[model samples]
Structure formats: structure tokens, C-alpha cells
Target: MTDYGHDLAFGSFLTPSAGTPEQTVSLAMLCEQVGLDLVTFQDHPYQPGFLDTWTLLSVVAARTERVAVSANVLNLPLRPPAVLARSAASLDLLSGGRVELGLGAGAFWDAIEAMGGQRLTPADAVQALAEAIEIIRRIWDTDTRGGVRVDGDFHRVHGAKRGPAPAHDIGIWLGAYKPRMLQLTGRVADGWLPSLGYLADGDLAAGNLRIDEAAAAAGRSPSAVRRLLNVSGSFTGSGTGPLQGPAARWVDDLTRWALEDGISTFILGTDDPDDLRRFAAEVAPAVRELVAAERTAPVPAAPVPPAPVPAAGPAPLVQSRHAGTGFAVVPTPDDGVRRSSRRVWDEAARPTGPAPDPARRYTRQELVGGQHLIDIHDHLRAELAQVQDLVEQVAAGSLGVGAARSHLNTMTMRQNNWTLGTYCESYCRVVTTHHTIEDQSMLPHLERADPRLAPVVDRLQQEHLVIHEVLEGVDRALVALVSTPTGMDELRAAMDLLTDTLLSHLSYEERELVEPLARLGMH
Candidate 1:
């Protein structure tokens, strides 16, 4: 086995479609919302049907809060190393240190030449890429007291000033396959990125051997280079093939790749939103869990040493002692305040989950799964508060409706809006996505794990439908606000209903499901 001991990362490789720019960016944001680690786009500057990858990366970074962005493999021939270095550094600084560089030697010579890039042979291309990597590294080395200098046949940077280091030590991954490129990757690159479709049987093993050998010869550890693969597959209900069956199948395949092939990062090249959701909510977590178990599994002959026991001590006495429940997670309580007289569902009719057994003990690690659900809900709550604040600012004439609309539109929250309408719409979409994930993935898993919780799960799903309608009502109010301009009361009413339903529903969910999730886990 060739496990590299790298922490597993999941990501999406999206197409920057010019035809549906909004959808593309929305999918990128969804990757972050669903807990993916990275978001990448393929670079094809010569293609008219695609958005410029660099520009799209900038927009995606702005739209998302915490997802690394990169080009799958930027075409190095078309982009100069010196300028690319500065651009990557600037974006890394702007995005709060979430940028990775994926570089590739030139491909599609005819298109590249047509776009004013130099055409070279395969050997020359590899050599040129090496020179570009040198130049790019030199440009980022601000601590070195002198101008960057790299003199090569393909690229020369003579006395070029080097400053503006990236916010973090950005990883330079290479899309390499050939012997020369593999050797170069092992010697210098931080990662090896290859598309699964480009590799045949045994190709990964063979390539790893070459890279490992090269790394050893260059006085470096083979584990220094992280392995990332771009994968594409379909999600089916039954067994089809590798990565083409259910989420469990994908997890099994990915776990094997991680343990045996040392592939730590799996980037799915998909455009379907459902696939993205399943990949994040199901496959990613399972793979991480499985890989972790195996990595920490005890060896056959070498038994692990027992943990040291604490010294015995007398128990402290308390005045008013009572039996305690093992569950420690505290659900957010509903404030029971309403801004509007409207109500979506009967609050008293909500079903309660079965009470947890006081005898059951839960580990801190196990309880974390329940806390994670609360963390996600807290983020939604914060965003909702921001939406309300923006609305109040616009209402008080502190923020211009046109300027707010323009800012949101530039972020691609929605196509059209007035003042805080787009921000509100974005928040609505996030709420909808969270509910959809619960309705489709988490609720089903919970139902299977604990049949006694059926009434609670059913009620949650029903509330999800009601919230969907509330969101649609918000959308309508936004449309009216755009046309009538004096429809702030209607908009405010819609927001009030949303706040009421969403907050109440979230608290009910936490109260009911937290214990079960802690006991049964999120699988």
C-alpha cells in the first residue's frame, strides 16, 4: 500500500459555462455550502463558449466564504509566469489565503498558436514548463533580497522585482503524465493532478513509481507531492461500475484509492447539482471516515500500548445532586417573537422525538456530529441577520437601493434585484439548499437508523415544504418591490414570516435530532 498520510480533501471541477454564468457560479457556492474543500474550473482561454477561468475564480472567491479556488490546470504557454505569479498572489491575499496553482504544459497546439501562443514540441513544452515554474517561484520569494532572475531558452525574467507574497504558502500543482513531467513534478511541484479519464489500468501505480524514484533521487520525500485526481462518474441506485453505483460505491472506491494509491484529493468533474450534493453529503464524509479508520487501525503484531490511567481520588460531594443525561448539546431556543401576524404552521402540533435514555453515555467525539448540525444552522442564522440589517439600511436611506442592487448583482447573487432583494434571495436559496439536503439525505438516513424518530422526521420534512413556500413568497415580494418601489411593507411581511418559520423549524430540528445524530452518527 502507498498511503501518503495526507488529509483527504473533496472538491468540484466545474465548467465555466458562458451560456449560464449564474448557474455556474451558483454551483460553486453550493460546493462551499455543502462542505466541499475546493472549487476549480478548467482553463480554456481560446474557447469562446467558456468564461475566462481566472475571472471566474475571482467571482467564485467573492461569492463563497470558505472554499479554495483554482484552475484545474492553467495553460502555462498562454500565460506568462511573472504576471501569473503576481495575479495568484493578489487573489490569494484578497481571498484570505484560499488559492492553489494548477499548472500545465501547453496542449492543443493549433488553438494555442491561433491565440498567439508559441507552439513547441512535447520535449520543449516540458522544458518550458520547468522554466516557468522556476520563474513563478522566484517571483514569489520576497524574502530573497534582490530582483528575481531566471534565464532560460523558453522564459527569461531578468532583474524583475519580487514582492507581494501570497497570504499563505500556495501549493503549485502540476497536471503531468509523461516521464519527464512526472520527474519534474516529483522534484519541484507540490502536487500531481491528473484526470481519471486520461489514465488506464495500472497507470496510477506506474506513475507513482516514477514520481517516487525521481523524488528520492532529488533528495525529497515521496509524500511531499500530494496526489489529486479529477474524477467524473454517474450516480445510480444500483451497482453499475466503479464510481457509477451508489454513494457507498464511490466511498469504497475512493477509500481504496486513498489507502492503496495515495490519492488524497478527489475532485469530481460534474455540473449536476444533485450529484454535487450527494458527493458532499454522502460520499465525502464516508470516505474520510473509512480512510481514517484504516490509517489508525492497530497493526496485527504490534499491539498499541494502553493509555495511562489516572490516580484514584475521592469523589467530591454536591449539596443537590440529580441524575444527569449524557447528552450535552444545547439546542438553540426559539425566541417566540413575531414581527408579522402571519403564521405558516401550528407550533403546538410539532412532534417531539423520543427522549434519550439517561443510561446512554456518548463520547465527546461522537457528540461532535450533533454540534456540527448546530454550527451549520448558526451560519444560516447569521446570514439571515445580515439580510435584515441590509434591508433596514436601505429603508433608512443610509444605503442607496441602486448601489446595493449593483453590489449584489456584481457578486452574482441573482440576476436582478432592488436594494437588499438580491441578498435576501441569496439567503433564501441557502435556506432552501439546507432543507433539501436534510429532506433528501440526512432525514432518510435518520429514518433508517431509528424508526422511532419517524414522526419527528416526517414533521421536519413537512416543515421543509412549508418553508419552501415561504421562500417563494419572499421571491414574489422582491418582484413587487422592484416594480412598485413602495412595497417595503409587503417585503417586510414576507421576511417576518420567513424568520418565524425558519427559526422555529431549526430549533425544533436541533432539539429532536441532536441526540439521535450524536448516538447514531451522521451516516
Candidate 2:
């Protein structure tokens, strides 16, 4: 439950205020300049003080080069589905696929009717939205032989020509929270868009469930539907209020939502330029770093074996150790070399598993299984040292900033701001993956094969989570290294913590698991 396995994205949700239309566009540009991933505007055809969402999006798309532009929730009643589809596709083409569509069921019936739109009941509106979704999809299906055709109650598109595909696969995000709307979103939409301010207590979780269930029922993967949120808060003196705290609070709160609530896209709704800058410059990257760390955190339990064939019943139990066996008893290696300056855990306090029977011996499979753990640990040890070297090299002037940048440009780290950020993220992923394999496959199998190993297995599992936190600390330091003047000291300290935890955890795991694994083969 550490992560929803979705990529984290951040954006600005600026209000389309008619009074300051230029300011709204300027803020959208500012968001791109500050590293925000997206820029969205609200739509309300009946609101006199609001600018037209579509027009504003067009202007924004023209101005910004990288950030995506979207209507937070386009007023669907005022814009026909077919026309909306064409407009979205055209803008997406013009913007080089930097466009996402967020549509909403009609709201404010009185105002809808005043604007020459149909006044549909709540039930009718939901039905209308569903039909609209079908119509839009049909219009975008250029590969189909026939013209677009969807004979629906509300939105029937007959023989409409379908051409001019968007530059990329455009996602249709829905602003929906009610059960029926949530269900519709799961069944058809690419993303679920909701504002945190409008959600009541527990609504976020409940909505996710509804959407997931609907997606499953419709034969779609739940992860295929992206979770997006419209959030608002202020950076005041004290770290209080929902999101009304400093940048650190924003990072923590948003990261928790991604980890626990499965909401990956965070769109901050604010008109203030300073708030926008802070959210982008400070909060966004930190949230990404935290969520990414957690996503690869160790799994708590064993996963179902891949392509597991049905067994007749249960296999006969074998003795733990026998004197003469298939292969030589490979002893667990202990080089007695400690690389870390600080010890993270009390190794003396580690609980012991059942001792192997002296009479029984090990098999070739078991010997290989045990040595595999050591091999993995050795790899992690090497990677950790490299990570430390990278940080120190940058700090000590052995590697100049320009040389670091040049080296990074050849790697995936070039996408990130700082070299440390790229290196730390990659190293953390490797460590997390190693822990994940052991926790999910190795430890569970060992525990099941020998129940007496429970205490040691539990301790190792706990250490995995602790190491995850340490890795996150390193990530936070990496983020700071880009903006803070004296970030090297912080980075070094963070790396030291990681080195302590990781080295200690790896040693403890190898010591405990090697013998058990040698006695019982890994599944």
C-alpha cells in the first residue's frame, strides 16, 4: 500500500477570470517556467465573470511549449460532444499533443437553460454524458471503415466524417465524484478529475472504489484510469490548515495522497504568482521523489507464483540437514569487513531461526539459492558505493558542474534538474527492487518452509521499510541540492544515513537468510 504505481504529475489550475484574462495566461506560462507539468483552466458557460475555457486553453496552448493545457472541467452542455472532440484534437495537434480534455456533466440548471442549453434532470445529464463519451470516441476512430455513428438518446452522431487524429493519444479526463458519475468514469474515461475542496469526508476513497469496480466490470485495468485532483492551499506563517502550510507541509500531504489515496496528478488552484512558483519550485519535485521511493518499497507478503501448476495435494517433508546429500553444504560467507561508519541497527539483537540439523545435508538447488542472496547484497554494496562517490565527486570539485551536466546529458538523468537527483533515484530503485524480490518471493518462501524463521523474517521486513524512509531522505536532500546554497553537507548527511541503513540491512538479511535458504530451496 505504499504506492498506487502511477507516475506523479503536478500542474496549476488557474481560474479563467474574465477581469484578468491576461494574468491567468501569464500564470500558466509561469507554471511551465517553474517546472510544473500541466496548466488547466475552469469552465462555466453561465458565469459572467469567467472567460471561455476553450478560448483560454487555445491561447495557453499557443503560449506554452511544454506544459499541457486543459479545461479543469469543460461545460459539456454548452459544447456538443462532436465539436468538442474536433476542437480537442485540433488543439492537441497544434500543441504537439500537449492537451487533455476534462469534461463535466452540466451543473446549475437555471443558468444552463438561460444560456440556451438543455435543462436536463440529474439522471438525464448522467445519461447525456455517457452518450457523449461514446460519440466522442467514435468521432476519433479514424481507422474505422464507416463514418462516425452512435445512435444514443442525447448525443447521436450520424455519418460524421472522422479524420485528422491528434498528435498523441489524448486522454479524456472526467470531473466526477458521485457514485453514478464515478462508475461512468471508470467504464469509459481515461482519467478521473476531482477537486479536494468539494469532496466530503471519505469521498476520495469511496470514489476510487466506485471507479475501480466499474473499471473491472467493464473489463479495464483500474490503473489505466489516471487519478487527478484540484487542490488549493496557502503558505502562511504557521504549518496549519488542510493545505495551508509551508512548502514542506505541501510536499508531505500531497505525497501521502499519492501513496495512500492513489491520486497522482495534483493541480494547485491559485491565482497568486508566488504560491504558484513555490508549488512548482519547491513542492512538486519533492512529492515526486517521495512517491517514487515508496512505489518500489518492499512488499509485505508473498505474491502468487507465476504460472503455478496445480499440485495433487501436499509434498512430503524432507529433513533440514543430512550428512550425505546431493551437494556440498555451502557455508554462509562472512568477510568481517564493515564499510559504513555508522551502524543503523543493533545486529546483536537479531532473532535466530531454527538451527539446521547436523545429520541432514543441503542440495545443489539450496546452495545456489543461499549464495544468490549474497550475490544480490554484493551488487547493492557496489551500487551504494558508486552513489556515495558521485555525491563526493561533485562536492570535492573532482567532477565540475559542467562535466557532471555533460555526463548527465547522455543518461536518463538529463531529464531531471540536478545530477544527484538522477543518480539517487536510479540507485534507490535498484535497492527497492532487491528488497521487493526478497520480501515477496524469498522471505515468504523461507518462512513457509520453516515457520521458526518468522522472527528473523519479520525483522528483515521491518528493516526494508526503514531503509525506504532513509532513501526518501536522500531524495529530499537531492532536491534541496538544486536550490539551496549549502546543500552538499545535507546531501552528504542524508547519504550517510542511507549507507548505514542499507549496509546494515543487507548484512543482516544475508546472515539470517543464507542458511534457511540453503536448507529450503527458493520457489
Candidate 3:
């Protein structure tokens, strides 16, 4: 496999439906809530039913704290390069670098002409897009000494003052599929953004080759051009239809796309909150862990002798036995600081990992396995916060129960009382899957390696059962909350119980496992 070594990223491609603008923005918020990296909306200004993509992006950016915002591919024909540059830069600056520009050549000539935009032939549109890129980049180069000037056939700017520079280096991602656009992307653009629907089954590899060749010809490294895709698929519990199968199929398919196609950024296109949550909480993390394992796998190499430490003046105070080898120091939370009120389990019963042997070191494989656990835990933590937020919204009457329930149903995507129940069910399934893997695979392996770890593993397994009960309790509360008029207290109590049990269990597990996982190894 060709490892581009580019850090993999995931995002969402939301539809900017005018009728459900609030829902669109809420979906973007959900993306941020569940730890997605970016959120984008499609731009089709001529469409009467769609909201203005730029305004929608601005609103989403303002609403979200972490997730980046962008247009799926802004229609360049409608937005002049100078104005588009300023608008993008302004948003990027306002959002504190959480903005990316996805630009496209003009499409649908009749609609473009109707909207008071010039209609260009296909070749001319591509050429114009190239010129627009040059103009946009020149406008954003605030440090350049002279006034910007680019004389092109389609767009020409003469001696225009440079930008109010963006907060960060904004990536110019091109929505490209044709060879010409792909080559142009390699030559100048920072990323290649293409929707899966537009590409044939085998087009990804061939497109990558073209981009790589053009990048080489342009004296730029192929890795410099980030490959980002806008993907859409359904999630079904049974039957195979692309992403309609189980979560395992998604993990496998996405992992292959990363390894073989060199696509580092995947933006899921969906309006459903449940689908978005599943993509973020389950599919994203699993793909990351699998890819990380492969990427960090040990490569065979000849052994080399360590350099002699000079018979120096003083001995080291904190000598690392793994001095020559690079091993990252693992992190942990501070002691006994509770963020919530309720308690589910006693913390004193928790076990700790074995003490360090200073002389003993960790293998790469062991470290990867340990890190994967933490990654999964992080996902759970984020989802828990979202669950709490939803509960509060329901209690406050800010989010109607019916509205919330509608979001929870992936099968129907309609309003119902099972929104909270369905959400809790999906989330509980994720927690169960995590524990099942540890109980069946990881704990057994660790116990086999060192008999002393048996106690810790046993405690962890017991906690898993406790957490499962806590999850069931939350489910029971949801059922009651839906049935009773004054069940807000029940909902809050259920969540608090979950918070206490899950957080404590996760912290305890990480504390006891991080070291052992690194030293003893994981399957």
C-alpha cells in the first residue's frame, strides 16, 4: 500500500435545503458535536429551493465551535474571483481558520444565463476557473509588495490592492473529475474534492495517477495535493448495497479507499442526524484505528548498534531505557474531578496498570493497540455529551419531543416518540461493541501474557457488565419519559447515572490498560 502519510480527516456534506434551513444548521452542529472535522453545504444559487450557500456556511460556522465550514463547491460563474476571495477570506478570518474553499467550474449554462451570469463553453469554463484561482490566490497574498494584477482571457484584475489576509492558509479545493481539471488541480490547487456520484467505479485510481503525473511535471510533490471526497451511502442492519450492510463493511470499504485511493478526507452527504452520528461515532473511529494499525506496523530492518554514551561527567537523572527509540508518552486525566452530580459505581474498586519496569520498553504493535482504545473512548465521551445536551433541550422544551424523535429514526426519518430511545439504543450498541471486543479479545490476551493482570482484567470485565446495566437503565428511563407528562426528572436522572458510570469506567480502564497495552501488547 502507498502511504501518502497525510493525516486522514472526515467531514460532512450537508444539503442547503431552504425549507429546512434550521435543520441543516442543526445537522452541522451535530457534526461538531460528534467530532467531525469539517462541514460543507452545496452551492447552487440558481436553485429557488436552496438557501444561499455562503450565508448558510456563515451561520453554520458561527454556530459550531470546532468543525470547519465550506461550500461543497461554490459556483465560480456566479461569484467573481475578487469578491469570492474577499468573502472566503472574511469567513476564514471570522471563523478563526475553520473555513475551506471548494470551487467548481460553471455548470448548467441555461440556468447560469438566467441568473445574470455569463455562460461559458465547457473548455472555457475550465480555463476561467484556472484564471479565477490565480486571481483569488493573488488577492489573498497580503505580504506581496506590489498591487495584485492578473491579465486573463476570462477574468482580469489590474493593480488591485491585496486582501485583508485570512486567519490561516485557506485550501483551494477543486471539484474535479475530468483530466483537464484534475491536471489543473495538481498544478495549483491544494486539494482535489470530488463527489462519488460523479465518478465511475474505477475513476478514483486513474484520477490519482493523472494528478500525480501533473504534480510531478509541475515540480510539486504528489502528496501536496490532498484528496478529499464527498461520499453518500445508506446504513442498513441487513442486506448488502454499497454502504447498506453492517458497520464492518463500512470500515472495510473506507479503509481501502484511504489505503489505495489516497483519499484522506471523506465528507458524508446526508441530512439525517442518526446517519451523521453513526458515521462520526462508529465508522470514522474504526476506519482510523484500522488504518493506524497498518500504517504503524513494523517494517523489517537491519539492526544497528547504539552509539556509546561518552564516559561523561554526571549520570542522567531520568534516563529513558527507550532513549534511542521513539515512544510517545501517554496522557491521562487529573485525579477525582467530577463534572457531573450523580454516581453510578464506586471508584475505589477500580484497578491500576502494572508499575513500570524502567528497563522494559514497548513495541510499536502494542502501542497502536493501546492508542486505539483511547481513540474509541474519546468518541464515546463526545457522544455522551451530545446525549446530555439533547436531554437538556428536551427538558427545557427547546427541542420538542416529537422533533427529537424524528431525528432519532434512521429507518423512517419521521417524527415519533422513540427519538430518545432510538438514539440511546444506537449509542448503547456502540458501547457494547467496544466492551465485547475488550472482553473477548483484549482482556484475554493481556491475562495470558501476565497472570498478575488477571485481577485488573476481571474488574474491567465486571465494570463492562455494570455499564451495560447503566445503558439499560437509560433505555428504561427513555420509555418512561415518553409515556409520562412530567418525566423530565426521569430523563435527567438516567443521563446522570450514565455519565457517572461511563466516565469513571473509561478513566479506570485507560489508567489500568495504557501501560499494560503498551508493554504486554494487544490483539
Which runs of model 1 end up more than 4 angstroms from their true locations? 302-523
Model 2 pairs in collision = 321-360, 321-361, 322-359, 322-360, 322-361, 323-359
- Candidates sorted by lDDT, descending order? 1, 3, 2
**Candidate 3 clash figure, as a count:** 1
As a whole number from 0 to 100, the lDDT of residue 507 in candidate 3 is 68
Give the alpha carbon lDDT tens digit for every residue of 1-523 in model 2.
4245677889988889899888888888999988899999888988999999899999999998999988889889999999988988999999999999899998988998999999898788999999998888777889888888888888888898986688888889999978889999999999999999999878888899899999999999898899999999988645556776666567657866887789989999988989988787667765665565454433222212223324665422121221133334233333445545666667668786665554554544447555655655665677688778777767766554554545455344323337567667767865765565567657888889888999999999988988888888888888777768767778888888887777766666665666677777766
Q: Give TM-scores for every candidate, taking all chains together and pairing residue i with residue i.
A: 0.60, 0.64, 0.63
TM-score comparison, 1 vs 3, better candidate: 3
> Candidate 1: deviation at residue 304, Å?
15
Q: What TM-score does candidate 1 get on C-alpha atoms?
A: 0.60
Cα lDDT of model 3 by residue, 220-319, tens digit: 9999899998888887765465566666556657877998898889999988898888898888876776676567644423223344555765433112
Sort every candidate by TM-score, greatest first. Answer: 2, 3, 1
Q: What is the lDDT of candidate 2?
A: 0.77
Residue ranges of candidate 2 with Cα displaced over 4 Å: 300-523
Candidate 1 residues 455-498, lDDT tens each? 99999999999999999998998887767756666777888888
